[model samples]
Target: MLDQVHLPPLAQDFLAYLSLEKRYSPHTVQSYSLDLSQFFQYIQEQYGGIALDSVKAAHVQSWLALGLEGRKKAEDAHKRAQPPASAVTIRRKMSALKSFFKYALRKGAVKQSPMARVTGPKLPGRLPVFVDEHVMEKVETNQAGDDIPLFSDDFAGATRRMILRLLYHAGIRRAELTGLRDGSIDFSNGQMKVLGKGNKERIIPLGTAVLKELREYIAWRDAEFPGYAGGALLLTAHGKPVQAWDVYRTVRKALAQVTTLKKRSPHVLRHTFATHLMNNGADINAVKELLGHASLASTQVYTHNTIEKLRRVHEQAHPRG
Candidate 1:
């Protein structure tokens, strides 16, 4: 049932390399496969059997142009047509191409990369979306009042609450959180050995409050699932390992109670973590390490959110008028 119709042999080889050697997540590999497939399909239909290395810059340019305009005709009438890809998506595809070509060049599959000189669509710089500090506090506490607790006192409630707390306090990605095993948490050191993108590992320090919650949750989990043999740090009602979607939905529902942000995701907690750190005078480089970013550029985005917050405070509190 595997469709290898339009994918060129070299492209297929490159994808295997990404999966096997680069250790990219399946989702990332699948994305690269889709992007490469689109490019190769366009090349086969439009240019007719051009060699992989012989592919011109114009071919890549034309493919991107068609994607942006949504002008490419669907291969079949049964397929639902999608709108033009947004700039962000287009940029991602371009990056995929760049990475693929880099691999291809190293293997001598291509003389040079067509994407070397090709420029992708300019992406608009947007600040990281985060919940306000006060809202985040409500999300974490879920205190009992005249109303029901935000996170109830059941296993499901504890798992959901812990998911949010880990994401916010650790500033870890959804995948990192989902992939955590019992051994991933180093309780003795107050740190977590997170396996980030590309199988890279970094030690993220866990705060005292988060560590306390984690211990309580672990005790609760052991008692709730006495026969639990699963290795994942989090589990479902059936004592099965938690999947990415499980964490996403749990965070989504938890965030819905506390935030009005249009995009309520576990990632919002990550954003909130970095932003709060910057607001409290945490160094950007230090936050970068905590967030496990490969480069400072990626971490710098959170600084904008903090700067905007400072601007608001200055506007409201400064008595120049």
Candidate 2:
């Protein structure tokens, strides 16, 4: 999809800057590429392929308007129109254009950024969705009882359980979990190093229970795939490295058994991890470091969830009337 789009040389250079200088992940770079490609395609069709520096704020506004209101197909008069973009999608496209124009200005390609005059719609406040502590415990442990292990005694089961545990316990992003290496775990320090966004590494402390499970999982993995010398911590049944999609599918299937939440992904486990820590009175800064968040603002969303929980408790436990 990224290759299909014909981006100008300046756009390609901007993408290189994101990948090399900014150290953005491939997935993030691809998203920017897609957004830029779509914008350029619109510019080509609407304005007859104007130079980047000549593009005006009105062009940017028109492009955004088209996104908010679905564009009708030119060739098919009777065909249904494409659905309008959601607030989130429009915001992302706006961000992509802003970043690209900023980069172009720095490179002296553009005298000014059109996005300086543009504004995105304000998104409604939405709290992060996380599983309850009890629900997560049920998912981790046996449905019959808490003492027994939930996963089967097989290599596949062991890997799946490890994926779930690391996501929830370490509060690592899905990419960070997949990027983990065999050497990332330090048994002596009781902490594991996670490679987070922008290739930043953070150390997450592991509990004794998690350490015990890690040791068992390592033994099982080695035994199942003997003579395998891959550096990846997680592997498929064929001994190849596990991918991001594999992690998502594994988490989705496991969470489906316990949670009815529409979002049954590894991210839900990460959210659950942060929310549970906040609920249990963990400091915001400590949780921020544990989750490898770039700023306190990103970590503060969990506090709202904690406040909601406190409100519910007060309503049920306290009686004034």
Candidate 3:
């Protein structure tokens, strides 16, 4: 819930709009709240508490500068120095302020948005990391080249394997995977409905092999815990619903076997799914829909990976004159 007492009326109203009207996740709402609170506090400390409507672009720029340059205390030599925020962190704060002010403008709370002229620091371009196709194939089988079974044989092993497959094949986020219900999967249609960020729902198509594995896993799960009638699609060993960390640990452990990437998480599987699809000639718009991205820009990042792959192929195949 939003802290009503600390925030100004307009800020609180903006947060409420984000929660009720915009349908932002609790985490996202809390982030906006924190960002607004921090900015307000900074205003109070730096400028003796300026009115919300009175805040200007200069104040926003100064706050961003403070993020880059940690607050200094000249008198306290022994005090621990505050570290500067990362570009990403500052960028998020900037975004939060922009959104809040935009809301305020729409609601007629302010004559103009202070964040209108404020520009965030430029972020460096980073390509998404993904496991190689050969390595991914190796992930499904053991060292002896035997196909891993997801049946009544071993519940724990089957659960872990199923988690890895769902993340890779379905390309769902950790939260989406954990929040899934048994009814989310439409076996007849070979598709699964996932609730994504901002409470947006999207349908992802499942392949025959993945669908078969899912059926086997669900059958084993139901048989193992007959008394369990929970709505969650995935469960823990204790028959409780799976959490974010559960998905992360499973992906990390499984990916550790096939690849040595520094960052091995459920999102890497998501990246892998998109990267593979782009490499194999999947339409960008289709990939966007599959990944549940709100904009074509978000989905366009995968094209960078495709371009890099093509660069490598051209270098290898072309002969120098």
Candidate 4:
């Protein structure tokens, strides 16, 4: 929720920049808009005559505190109304605030950024949970895909399997998976351009193993639906471009067979890809680039997985008397 107060000229501009220049995905943009809107509403109702753009660090801390100018304002109504948000939620809200202030700083809208030195609640160090290597190997195996049943041959069984393999092997985000166009793939070069968040584009290369499967799938697709779409690479059984839901369903069904992940979403595959790479000794920076992560901090979480692997190896190898 954004602040109820009228947005300053700069705040509106910042939102526009996020939408136009930054090209944040719709879901992300919508969340940002709501977070800001909620903040503004809280400021107006709680502080009465306070200027939202001039909010200070204390305001941010107070907003994040339980029962203080939050979603359920006034202690009387929200009394004993569930505990406040967890520290993790507080941390994320702070991050959103930090990003907003940074944007404001860039535009010179606010002389001093409120979140410049603000600290949010300390987040608990939750160990990264990853699939066991043996389990992952079993899960990633493309063999079981052969025994799967299909509702129709329109998307074709092969198409579904190829989709699963691409997401796992390439570690491409689901949106990036859908964004792929036919011409975007370079068979000769063995790479494809991935459009990630913030309109950032990067090239993802595939090993010969994945490239071979891709070629076979493409050939099959062409034979089934010759002269189908203009540039879109993946298509539904009816030769329509792959949608987000299609990718979700494909990944979900595949994971149901291989993984016990409760959510079994495509992003879990992305996490699995990063964790596996780190455990195998891939450089953190290199993994960051491969995933198109904007900040190294975001990628560093994978280090936890590597550390866990090292601990296991040390415990097994070292003999303690």
The whole-model lDDT of each prediction reads 0.86, 0.87, 0.85, 0.75
lDDT of 2 by residue, 111-194 (tens): 999899998877867998899989887866745244645667678877888898999999888999888998999999999998
Q: Against the correct fold, how does model 3 do in TM-score?
A: 0.62
**lDDT tens per residue, model 1, 200-252:** 99999998888888889888888989988758999777777889999889888
State which candidate has the highest lDDT: 2
Scanning candidate 3 in windows of ten residues, the lowest lDDT window is 143-152
lDDT winner, 1 or 2: 2
The sequence of per-residue lDDT tens digits that candidate 3 reaches over residues 214-264 is 899899899989987859988778888888988888778777766789999
- Estimate the lDDT of model 2: 0.87
Point out the worst 10-residue segment of candidate 4 by lDDT.
66-75
TM-score of 1: 0.63
Count of backbone collisions in candidate 3: 0
Residue 278 accuracy (lDDT) in model 3: 94
lDDT of 3 at 126: 99
Clashes of each: 0, 0, 0, 17
**Which ranges in model 1 have alpha carbons more than 4 Å from their true place?**
1-122, 143-146
Model 4 C-alpha lDDT per residue in residues 1-321, reported as the tens digit of each score: 234344555556767888899998888777776667766666766787475467898887777774223444355574344456777767767776788888877767678789876777677776555555665565445444466443234546677766777787788999999988877789899998888999998988888887887888788888888776566778887788889999898878767776576777888778878898888888899999999998999899989878877888889988961
